[model samples]
Target: MKNYDKYTREYFTPPVSSLKWTQKEYITAPPTWCSVDLRDGNQALVVPMNLQEKLEYFQLLLQIGFKEIEVGFPAASETEFAFLRTLIEQDLIPEDVTIQVLTQSREHIIRKTFEALQGVNKAIVHLYNSTSVAQREQVFRKSKAEIIDIAISGAELVKTCAAQTDGNFQFQYSPESFTGTEVEFALEICNRVLDVWQPTAQNKVIINLPATVSLSMPHIYASQIEYMSEHLNYRDHVILSLHPHNDRGTGVADAELGMLAGGQRVEGTLFGNGERTGNVDVITLALNLFSHGVNPHLHLENIPEIMSEYERLTRMKVSKRHPYAGELVFTAFSGSHQDAIAKGMKWREEGNGPHWSVPYLLIDPKDIGREYEGDIIRINSQSGKGGIGYVLEQNFGIDLPGEMREAVGYRVKGVSDRLHKELIPDEIYEIFIEEYVNITAPLELINYCFTHRDDYEATVSVRMGEELKEFTGVGNGRLDAISNALRTNLGMDYTNLVYKEHALEIGSESQAVTYIGITASEGTVYWGCGIDNDVMTSSVKALFSVVNKLHHSTSTQRLVNNR
Candidate 1:
């Protein structure tokens, strides 16, 4: 907070007001995306990618549907020039895609840049010079007229070099550090360059407005773009492009608003990898359009694969919290969020709507090669009954009853809390099995038979703490008869027996699962589950499980009270 007065606003507002971009609600279409990963991104790396790595990365960009990619500054180094030659010599460049190379306004760099494209089918000769006031006063130490001469001479040389070269060429010019340059001077310099090129519809030239150093809010950049778009000499024949840096962490915003203000193309790197804070993240920009129902015109169906390849080739780790592609972006750990997501998934499963409207999710994970099980309802100390129950049902096909899920939730959360870790689906399933399913302590069924008289009659042989016995009782139903037999024979007291059964569709089609709930005298409900080939056997086992749970819980409570 100290010495804050040293910092001052460096960006310039246009001489005239241009507020027409404010009326647009959203970007209706995706911009012309040109990836600079091999150029700008590689230059920022600690160890630049080798020829092989660049080749693989170029193929990846092609797969991601980039029609234009800036390969590198050919005159920068031998490696840069060789990489371009490799792509052209090996015929690695696709016919529909164009490779671009950056060069300074100097004649030799322009000649070598064109030399790298000797046999290329199609290419863009990108020319740029620093035009910001800081570069003029401190770096170049030249007047505005001298800077304009540099751009014009470079444009003339590039046009001359392309004519003598053996490839179809397009021209793109950028006033580097355009953000810190005076808007009027920026306009004048761009118009002067256009006068020489005289671009037409069939041969449109790109006039790139770069926020080489982002210094203001996004609206200011948008208004600047609007001024350029409206006042450019060859407005219809020029492709207005934006290349925003993320020094202020708003490169994506600048690009979006600039597009809304009549910019037609974007030049950025994937994952925002470039100098300083990095270029605008083309992935974020494209996916933002996608979330708004516009096709980003890129194949992003498998973000995980793209991230893996990007990391492997570039040696850069995509953060786990990165938007849309991050590992934890779709994971919900909060109890309330988990509950809503679980319910939303169920709602979606029931054919509620044709569109994806799930709670706590901006887009469906499955649409981006992510699964719902581990990626969605991850269980920790903060998990809720709905999320835990949803995990059980989705992973193991064990749907807990509505009344029973809260009880199971507490038990699971207690284990996770004590262990200080998240429980995987298998671990959660094991906990369910050990704590509630077919428990056979204090009361166990050895054998049983049922008969239907006017009332159903049942007889059972059971074990209780190393003792075996037999009992008989008659009730309105078979399960009720078994309950009556146990209560009478064991002198146990309970009421309000609840039972439900369903076929076990996951592990075995022939097996059936049954759930039972019984209210103790102290007004606490104990729950249990059983699985067997026969529905009747499962139901009887479920009843016994509930009785065992009740006995153990009471025993533990009494021990605690006595202590």
Candidate 2:
């Protein structure tokens, strides 16, 4: 903390004041997305991908709907050169997709880059040279004039190669490390390149402003983009692009605000895989629009398959907390969060609205190859009764009473806490059954005969410990009649019987589930559940369960007091 004085704001602000981009709420449309996973992302890996691996990743980018993908720097290595040749010779390049390759200002590398482009249908020859202040004095050891000459020479060479080459080609130039360059100087170099390419409506140029090393907050980057958007030559014929890296962990924010400042395209890798912190994540950017009710023009519905192929090909593990594509992004482990999510999902289900407005979730998990049963409301020591009850109703179709859910939640949480692990759906169901369903110990239901003469008279035979006892009572309903019979004949001091029933709607079994709650003499409530094919039988079993639960609680209290 004492070294704080060493860090200063090295970023330059745009010349224009009161930027208009700050007034925008959100991006109304998605930008043209270009994936550099095969180039920028591959080079950063501990081990570069092989030929077959590169091919597999290329196909994945195509499947993900990338119209422009930077395949690799063909002239940098033999494998990269060979990968381009394979794509061209094998006719693997789709007609609609245009592959881009990176190169520098040197002549031999430019020539060899064009050689790899032979027989290709369409491609972008991307030429770049660092123009930052540090690069000029330290890395490149060149003056401002020399840097401009490097970019202009590369621009002219790219034009000459496009004319001689056998394939269709376009031009793109990036002032690499543009964020570290003065705004006016960055514009000057880019305008000189535009002069050589002479981009038209049909043949547009892409001037990518890469945050090669992010140095400041996103607002500063947004201001830089706005300055470029306003002052750049051939503005109508140029597709302003942004390639933001996450050095400061604000790449996504930078891209969003940059787009609002008039950027028309994005260049990033999936899951933000690249140099340093990584490239801005295209998946996160695209789905952010999807969550805002705008189509991102990318097929991200099957995210699991995309993630699987990405990890397999790149050998880079996607973080479990990665936005939109992580394993646990939609999962809620906090009790309050789970409860709100549960209620929100139920509201959506009952209304069946067109828009997604779930409380904790920005978008529906089901829309992206995720499920609510296990993925959304996960049970743990921190889980609450609402979530536990939602799991039962949503997965197994057993809706527990409100008070009963509290009791069952505590029991489930106790088990999870002691074991120090999360409980799965089947395990939670098993716990529910073991703790509260059809529990008969001190009092067991033998049989019941109900005669509806005046109201409803019921004669029930029950086993109390080792004795078989018969009880008779009258009430309006069969459940009430059984409760009356138990209290009157067995001297059980309980009242205010409450119950609810519903038909099981999930899975293969056809049965009815009933919940019963009763208040004992000490004003303590006991709850139980019964599942059976017949509703009447399930109700009787439910009442018996509550009686046994009440007796067990009293006995436990008595033992504790004696101790």
Candidate 3:
């Protein structure tokens, strides 16, 4: 706080701009994505990736459908140069892919970069120079004219090297600190390089404007990109690209807005890994577009595999809360959130057509290889009846009645609260079975014979502990008559019996599951479940289980109140 006076806004604002990119609501299409993981991202690592690691990462980039990849700065290191040679000599570079290498505005490095590209089919000789005001004054000690001359000289040398090299080459130029440089100066230097390359309809040039260090809000950068796109030389022949770093945690925002401002390509890393905060996350950016019903043109169907490989090779961990890719991004733990998500999923299941409007979920988890039961409705102390019931119905095919769900929900929450952890689907099912399914305790139904006539009658044999007793009661329905037999034999009393049944298909064939709930005299409700191959037997077991639960709970509550 004491040094707050020393820092102020250091970013340069471009001349008054009438911005049009704001009118667009979203990115209409995918941009040409170039992964800089091998270069920009690798350099930022504490222990940079080795040759084999780089090779593995290169294959991953290809698998993700990156057309252009900045493999490395060959002139900077022997390993970088060797990686390029290995890819070229081993025929690893795909015919459709183009490898790009970086260099500064020097002659020998430029020559060495070309040497690394020898015998390659296609390559992009990326030439860049620090053109920021700070770099010109402090680092280079050069004037504006001198800086422009540096870029121009690099452009000419790249052109010469491409002609002499034994490989096909394209040209790319970057104002390294475009965000910190004056907008007009950035344009002027890029145009000077364009004038040298003379890009045509058949052969296009890339003009990359990097937010080497984020200096302002994203819209300001978008405006800068728009100004350059509108006034750049040979606009049709130039591919305006954006390389945003996440120093401000808005790299994705900058890339999206920049595309709207006429940029056609993005250069970033897998999970935004780079120097300070890292580069823009190409995965997040592409998937954001995918969520809006636009195909990102990249294969990100299996994100878990991608994240695993990325972390293994890079020694970096993707956060559990990262957008669209994190483990917990789609998971709901709050009771209300889980309830809504469960209801929304049910609505989708019951609907007649395809629509992805699930509440609290922007995209379907299944699209990215995530399971709905495990990943969506997670169970914890905060989970509710709807989510818990949904988990059972979806994974285990046991549907609880409305009031039974509430009772079971509280029981599950109590267990989770005492254990201080979240419960998995198996654990939840085990709790359900242990607590409510076919419980035979103070009372157990031994046998039942029913007679259906104008009025229903039944002779039921039940066990009260070690003793067996028979009771005959008559009622309008078979189940009601059975209830009447229990009351006549054991003096049982309850009301408002409710039940639900469904076929249990998971790990079972021809299995039926039934749930029952009953209200005792004190307005306390108890729930139970029974699973069997016969629906009638399952229903009888469910009724007996609920009766036992009610008797045990009432006795326990009475004992505790007396104490």
Candidate 4:
């Protein structure tokens, strides 16, 4: 018979289809989480987060509903030891939040770990060892009995230490490569350790089973989890934990499978930053439940705050395109996506019944701390009539002519292809106002320039519509100087209109297109578009356009700041 470990690594097939479980099979449970940021995430980082950063992160973890935070290995480094000491001496560990420390099964290191948490109010000593065919044969070159002895001796040492400690101490043991280990041998070692510890329902022992080096297909991993779920003994007195790595890029699926197969606890870092392809992402898992109409213990709404704190502490920029927590996760750029999200949102707002739009949205952005209302994100050209009309309908309640949406779609495609970037709201507004809304003749900007020396200030020149209306002023960069020149010539803040530049093209160096929207006393939406090689010109043209929009809207519409 082929070793299932070797066979499973090569090919994995699901034991059953997802449809096998109905709605009744899906039950949300209060999850026990353990963040491996310090140990797992730190090792995986290119430049590891320092002690102070780790301390800040530790506090942030507590602020979130994560009760079990696995701090770094105190036995590893002076920095880790000092940070652990600071965490202990500062007396900051919450009553509910129990600090967990990881150590190898070795006696010296385990004692050093215990020494760090000596006075700490609450602590869990997590001890783990590699226990798989490959690890035993290659890593230690030890037989199965020899490996079990290593683990058993480690647990016995922990029991002795726990008896010695005055403060609250619990023991956690992980069969490091549990997913790939032989089931009967794995159970034997687990039951051996459990017998030594004598864990009860109230005093539950955590047995974390890591998919250490995720080597199986997603379904194989799921089957392994289900098989283990059905086999692991002391079912009531043990907290079955899962720690999956993204070696196969199926860590998320692996976690879902484990949970489905009856895992009560999960241990991972935020965004799954760890060794190799990293660990399973905890944030994604919890929010996945939130999308499925089930609640995860982790608050879905405090995501931004949590991310902000993590960023501040870790000094690592979360990619803007990262799911839910990213800057643009909810933003739709594709025509179909924007159109679908828009129509879905409209249907969602209709309070007559339950929503049918969860198709486009895998998880609701509201589950995380995002403020996206499914507004159709306009880009240069990849938009259809639905998206363009939606934007027009949103900005101004005036519905554009049907043919105009088609024309606008073509124009948008042209712009998108030319710009090579997503078109922003103000940019779309500018194009619409220019092409559709007939603004007879407003402030026409002819040309502008700045002449300045190394010692003195700068000058501004503007040619307004064939009429060379040039104003020379002295100030900083051409933007402020030009604005001052405008105030001097075009009158004061009587318009009560503000113009903000929204980028038409993305990238730091590329020209950021500005659309200036202004309001009138009567109320209207006037928009202008300015594209230039120079950013100052763009800013000035944007202001110039806002001045036009304010003038036109006041004449035709109602007031300023209309949605």
Runs with alpha carbons beyond 4 Å of true place in candidate 1 = 375-563
Best-fitting candidate, scored by lDDT: 1
> lDDT score, residue 198, model 3?
100
- Model 4: how far residue 212 lies from native, Å: 0.9
- Kindly list the per-residue Cα lDDT of model 2 for residues 1-563, writing each as its tens digit: 99999988777787777289999999999999999999999999998999999999999999989999999999999999999999999999888999999998889999999999998999988899999998898998999999999999989989998899998888899999899999999999999999999999999999999999999899999999999999999999999999999999999999999999999999999999998899999999999999888899988988877886787677787776788877667878899999999998888889977788888798888888876555456677766687788888888888888878888989998999899888998999999888788887888888999999778899999887799989999999877788888888867898788889988888746788889999888899889888789999988888888888888888899999999
Candidate 4 contains a number of clashing pairs equal to 12
The local lDDT score (0 to 100) that residue 177 gets in candidate 1 is 93
lDDT of model 1 at position 145: 96
Task: Write down the lDDT of every candidate, Cα atoms only.
Answer: 0.91, 0.89, 0.89, 0.70
Candidate 4 lDDT by residue in tens digits, 410-506: 6766776687776776787676667533232455666667767642233444445556666655556565566556656765333333444444433
Arrange candidates by lDDT, descending: 1, 2, 3, 4
List clashing residue pairs in candidate 2.
none
TM-score of 3: 0.68
The alpha-carbon deviation from the true structure for residue 357 of candidate 4, after best TM-score superposition, in angstroms, is 3.2
When summed lDDT is taken over every stretch of 10 residues in candidate 1, the lowest stretch is 372-381
Give the Å shift of residue 134 in candidate 2: 0.5
Better of 2 and 4 by TM-score: 2
TM-score of 1: 0.68
